[model samples]
Target: MSPLLRYPTVDELATRAAALVTRRPRDARLERVGTSRAGNPLLLLSVGHGSRHALVVAGPHANEPVGGGTVLRLAERALADPALTENADATLNLLLCLDPDGLRRNEGWLHGPYTLGRHFRHFFRPGFLEQPEWLPDGADAVTLPETRALLDLQDELRPLLQCSLHGVDVGGGFVELTHDLPGLPQRVAHTARRLGVPLELGPYDTLYWPSLGPAVYRIPPPRRGDLAAAITEAAVESTWFHPYRHGTVTAVVEAPMWGVRAVQDGSPCADPTAVLRTVSGTLRRDTQLLERISARIRPHVAAAPDAERLLAPVDDYLLVCPGLADTWDPDTDDGPHPLPPLGSAHLAALRISGRRLALRTAGLLHQLVTAAGSDPADALPELDRLLDAWCADYLDGCGARWIPVARQVEYQSRVVLDALALTARRADSLSGEPDWGSQAAVPMHRE
Candidate 1:
């Protein structure tokens, strides 16, 4: 347990950030961006004196709060050495945590007895449609106050660079960029290696997305009205970084909570079909388990006063996801070449995603059970026991191990610093100036 993993709650983060800003009254200042849907303050720390500005955002998703630590550390580093940013002509603006309401929901396991069981027990992620990172479509009048606040800041600042810090539940780390800048991928890979975090080479979340390198991918801006498509399209389109399209040069660091060597292996399989079967088989098993839990809990949920609100979303997610598993057809060859080997990271991601869905369904069921005033003495505990046992089995099967919080923070921060330095170098080269030899030379982009 690294001291870095002493994950702070929303209140604690606000308090600590305020103190840090107060100490450097002349250089650093804190501002209230807006309030979350739950009314927690969305705060930002402004550091350094320069014409160029960079915005660093974290905690976009409740489950991926590792970025909160990274941003906080960066804020402290910038304040301690004003020369760090002043020389680069870059001002650092840090949004400590974006989704404070969602973050509080995950705080139960933030300060760990950090075990897989405890983490899953306390997990809570909103549906794709409800996530703050995804901007609402025109047809849907839904809008999150947090999203509006961040968008307002981006429009006002039009930052030269924007970095969104994120992390995974398992497997190695990866990077996502808004556009391809020369040598940026190599810098990202080198930073990960130096920090001892393996880069995930397996097909996971980015299976269908375009790749820039082994674990680096580009995030395409959503076309107009694309959010009105399927849930997947809408989810991808909701990325907050996309709206800053005026050459903002966005970067996302997705480190993992735990990693294994299997995640990095990309060797070809003699029987690619068998690999697909294995992956599909895992999803099937997870789906069946969730279906079983849902069946048992449905009766109680239906009897609850707010039954429609509790049951509809959980039922919808389960329906779409389990069917998605059946869509994996290795026998069909639609591509120019043979199917690639199913990487360990892909398998881990599949299993983890399924488990999260099941846990989320169980959580919803628990709420319904409690709300209905029904005696859930047996059903809720059974659901938890089954889910925990399944997670333990999955971990054993995948060979997953714990990663220290300090290491994750270190890797994420280093990547951001390296990227900022690279951007500065690019700006200098374009201006016909020589490299300043330090990250301090990195300048924020001019409008």
Candidate 2:
């Protein structure tokens, strides 16, 4: 296997975007789209002019660096092969990085080896108010300027397709769509298999959303809400509002960062109840860790408003845990499967891995607080030791390993192209235009 790869630093990423702009001024314009709470300018790179538009937003979360490469690939591809974007009728309105501040904070891991240890050590994700993608729109919500910028762009563009490219720290590769299109599932699955990547046939982030087939899915209705939405009336990314408002086909791509074969192994589990217990146990332990750390650092977090912002995930997770679906009951059948298409045991273990990854932000905050001299009693070392063990368990127990940067980007690019083609074909058919032969059709494979 190829060794894990590092992504360009934030400065290098900006230079690359600038290069793309200079390469095809007629086709591309890199402009400031919005501003982060930290006053960083959020940029949007627009390339090509096609019949329909596909808006690709990346870097919604701090650690998921794969999308930056994917966006660059698609933009350069459009500049090089005009027909590629034309055939898909996609103008390629791309948000290179929505969270520049977050990206800079994650630069330690971003421009280094994408290992689990490095990630947890340098982890940093903002609270609901700080996250642009999940910023709330309701009266009580404090909407970040970046969130407003995205909503404004959506209104102005009214895009035909929107893709928020993301990466998962573990488990299988999967895609979620706001509107299901014919043939997408097969395409996504075939692409994953082509790369020797496991499809997320088991439960993961989009647990409540209905799957179309295999790893492809139609995102849950906007009314259903999410972890952020639970805290705010209108969580930006969770509801997937583009589909309903603009008639856009919104998609979220999760390329796995680590893998265990069992993530895709579908078989009848010898015991279903045991799997559920294991899942519940992990959740219980994670929640307990969050509680201990948050309680220990609550005063410091309150004293230092910045610390409060850092502890948002821990706070929000605790706030919403009672309603969160991490607790699965065997008799309830509240998961993808009790057996087959991923046996209960394997899928349940996946739940453990996801929780571990999610709670890492809390652990990171613990480290931050202790390092800052907030804990007079040095409450963090004992907790940090336990956290170290959990991280080890995640890496060793789940068979965590690097998913090369190139492979991850390629998988995302393939899926986005396939989706663009499907949407473009639909546009042609809906227009009642006479078939322009090959132009009217999008081949599943490259010519």
Candidate 3:
């Protein structure tokens, strides 16, 4: 068993990971990849002799932590799995917690002897300007020690695969990023299946509306230079999109730990011994398939027009690039307070524009419930209701906004209702019965 998983704490996790690297009997080495704004070391555990390397990072966002645990667990497992540790064809290096200060804020939950409810509540805070992870120094932009560390490490490591383990809401499903890595999606799907998590697909755009898509979208047209079009300018500033700017071509997987408890029945096997069998199996399959596909396409990465186009789907995330919503001012509580309840008009528009995506997302949740060997019909509606209420409270109460945040509430309400209905229908079809005996099973799907 890994020593770190024995006790959970932000400090303990980092210390244990560092200790593991220090004590590694393998030929690999431990190095400092980056430092948090608070000066916490972003350590990298590097193993293998292959030129092809994969970088795994977690804790990019303070609230989302499954990746931190995953990286630690993966490191310990790799130590014993010769196939993972003895790789001569590729190397795997992990960046555990890019934002240690943000991580520090959530230490109570990580090393918790607390109840699950308290742990979850205590750790769930949003990323704001004050967060060490988001605020880099002005002008240079990359001045944030953590960002600099990662940039420097990327230069030094030149990883071919980079997976940042992240989770969405308590209601999220697993998803992977990147157009590269052959059979990458399948591996992600398979891993989620083994873990009893679901995959999110569909209109995630609504989640990033007016910032990324057909909804008043503004992505800073692919280039820089001119404010207006000229008749015959000597130099033309063309707009271009660099997908790599925000994401990596390296294989990236977003693992949702939202339903992790359901998937593995709340298994407390945080240690290498308990989790090694699963991690090794998943990694072996993922690597074998990913390598085969990558080998076939290695020659084309350079020639691919609009290199960013390849990353479109995976790069799309609400948290990556947020909307133009105002941040909550800590100094003054004078902002959009007492958010209006979601309106009917906004709800209608969201339903029309976001139905498909909502359905797809719902399908992912359904998959999670079913994969856990739980009756989807029995579990999904309850999950949907819980998520809806949670979203409502989150959008409305988390912080004061000048603009009514109720639109988000309404959007989520409609989304939750629709999801519940859709999941019920799908579960019925699979089970060949339309019976959900509980009265609570029925959602307020009418609206």
Per-model root-mean-square deviation over C-alphas? 4.6, 4.0, 23.0
Model 1, 241-355: lDDT tens per residue?
5545655778887888877656676664465557566655666676676677678767656768756755665665676654545544464443223333465555545555555
Residue pairs of candidate 1 with colliding backbone atoms: 88-440, 134-238, 424-442
Better of 1 and 2 by TM-score: 2
Top model number, TM-score: 2
Error of 2 at 139 (Å): 9.9
- State candidate 1's TM-score: 0.86
- The numbered model that scores best in lDDT is 1
Local distance difference test values of all predictions, in order: 0.70, 0.68, 0.39
Better of 1 and 2 by lDDT: 1
TM-score of each candidate structure, all chains considered together = 0.86, 0.86, 0.48
1-447 per-residue lDDT for model 2 (tens digits) = 222255655566678899888877888889887888788878889887665677898888777788888888888777777666654455788888878788887776776656676677777776665666653444235366777777777777888778888887777788887777788888887888788777776654655556698878676555535554445333244425744576887888888777655666666778666766676656666667667766776666465545655666667667644333344544445433333334653564456554664457556666567556677646667656766776777777766667778888888888888887776666567777632212334456432
What ranking emerges by TM-score with the best candidate at the front? 2, 1, 3
- In candidate 3, stretches whose alpha carbon ends up further than 4 angstroms from where it belongs are 1-8, 112-121, 124-140, 203-248, 260-447
The global Cα lDDT (0 to 1) of model 2 is 0.68
Q: How badly does each model clash, as a count of residue pairs?
A: 3, 1, 12
